[model samples]
Target: MSAGAAAIRVVVVDDHPTFRIGMSALLAATPGLEVVGQAASRAEAVGVVLGADPDVVIMDLDLGDGSGVDATRELLARRPEVAVLVVTMLDDEHAVYDAIRAGARGYVLKEAQPQEVERSIRSVAGGGLVLGAGVARRAMEGLAARADARPFPQLTDREREVLALLAQGLDNAAIARSLFVTTKTVRNYVYAIFTKLEVKDRAALVVLAREAGFGGDER
Candidate 1:
């Protein structure tokens, strides 16, 4: 930002032409930032970043030609020093985590204020990580939830409950009565639980559930 100091060069990669152009214009107008290149697909992104050698790359998750996550991974593999900041409409936990795993330095929704986007670009360019407020909260909550995860994490809550009841030596009719559900519904849940856990029958399921400490409560 200061005199004689070089501005941070940046590249914008998005599938939408309007967004890419708008973002480029915004960065070009901002002090201490320079718009070096623009790309609209995975292949183009790699080529542009390599050619421009930007300090930061603004990436979108949905690239019509290919995925931005894959592009980020390929770009970082070739240019490890370049930081990638994902700016897109996707705010789901899966999308956020996938981008992080793909070596993105920051993730912010497209709805983020222009000022916020500018700050994120500066942060990542300086080797700092950034996330939008909502993204950060969801990421942290997901991590915390994983830290204390329960057994059979793949099972739904109701399925786990059925498994637990089965471990307590309850038959389908008993489980149906206990859960206030019809016998057919209980049977369906039991079938699903068996399929998910990959147990051949009730005996194996009960053994596995008991070992995992699921059936300790008195009936």
Candidate 2:
């Protein structure tokens, strides 16, 4: 926290003391970063996040007392500006979707290289979303399985198609091309998707899709 230091304040939340220590050391020694706090449990993690007001939170999705997903939700609800970057061993499709639902800005596997983790923190801090290598695939499969069953069941054909692509992580351009429509129309469809689904963002929509049966198949 110096003049033009380029530092990103971060907190490490993991149950394993050893991993926490290692991450703390790495973040402390890395350029443009400062390890502001550490937490070992769900409640502790929430407290540390709220108290420290760190720019980025490096968290494990599996905490001792509460799910890391819930912690992320609480942290974001309290301070939505604070970014949550999930750095955990849970890479399953459901786990990934759950993290997204909880409002994580990024996701990275614990097995990722140290630099990759740092990059993720920086990316989230700078307002860019990030995801681990295999997490996107998991999300996509999760989305596909969800498209089979309609969450709304009341959406028209176009709205359902747009929602399906939205759950696939497609922005307006991609959705437009896929549906042979203009970007403006795609944006309108996206608006309708959110309005009908009663979700706020793409992450939440994707989670709903999986819950609706979007992840049972890979293709």
Candidate 3:
């Protein structure tokens, strides 16, 4: 959906000038999104974010001044309303887990296609989290085996119910119908599950379910 005529305002922060420029152009042209500012270092990033007050911050993992993870934490602490989305080459679990802990709304590998990056921006801005495809699954498996932030957490009963449905490959609509709730309600549950379980998306949800010895029928 277009989600109304107002576009998603965003700032691109990366150490690489080329990456900052390329992402700025790509995101600006995407539907329902606009690149309001750009920065190539940690200091510049903070300036752009504070100056633009954008809805989303597309941040690189390695900036000129420091790791983007640091920036993510600081930004959230400073501006709790503004969201950070990590878009970089770092695929390490530490990076992914740290970013999430730092209050990142989404994590996209640099290898993710341009479309995926744009989709992530929208997803996070729309109150959802995006995890790298396999990351979610791996996190789940680790969770099933051990309660670790590797990056799963203590999933509550209701959250586990939601995750189970997600593992069955149910979309928000189907899950809502099965649970006799509204789609918006299901979306909220899914987001909570992601944060609590430390899984990123449906694919990871499934992997974690299997590793935990759960099936669609288990719920």
Each prediction's TM-score versus the true structure: 0.70, 0.65, 0.63
lDDT of each: 0.92, 0.85, 0.82
**Whose TM-score is greatest here?**
1
Q: After superposition, how far is residue 121 of candidate 3 from its true place, in Å?
A: 0.6
Stretch of 10 with least lDDT, candidate 2: 210-219
Locate the minimum summed-lDDT window of 10 residues in model 1: 210-219
Off by over 4 Å in 1: 144-149, 152-219
Clashing pairs in 3: 136-204, 137-204
Model 2: pairs clashing at backbone N, Cα or C within 3 Å:
142-214, 142-215, 144-214, 145-213, 145-214, 145-215, 146-213, 146-214
Ranking by TM-score: 1, 2, 3
Off by over 4 Å in 3: 1-4, 137-219
Best by lDDT: 1
Shift in Å, residue 60, candidate 1: 0.3
lDDT of residue 117 for candidate 1: 97
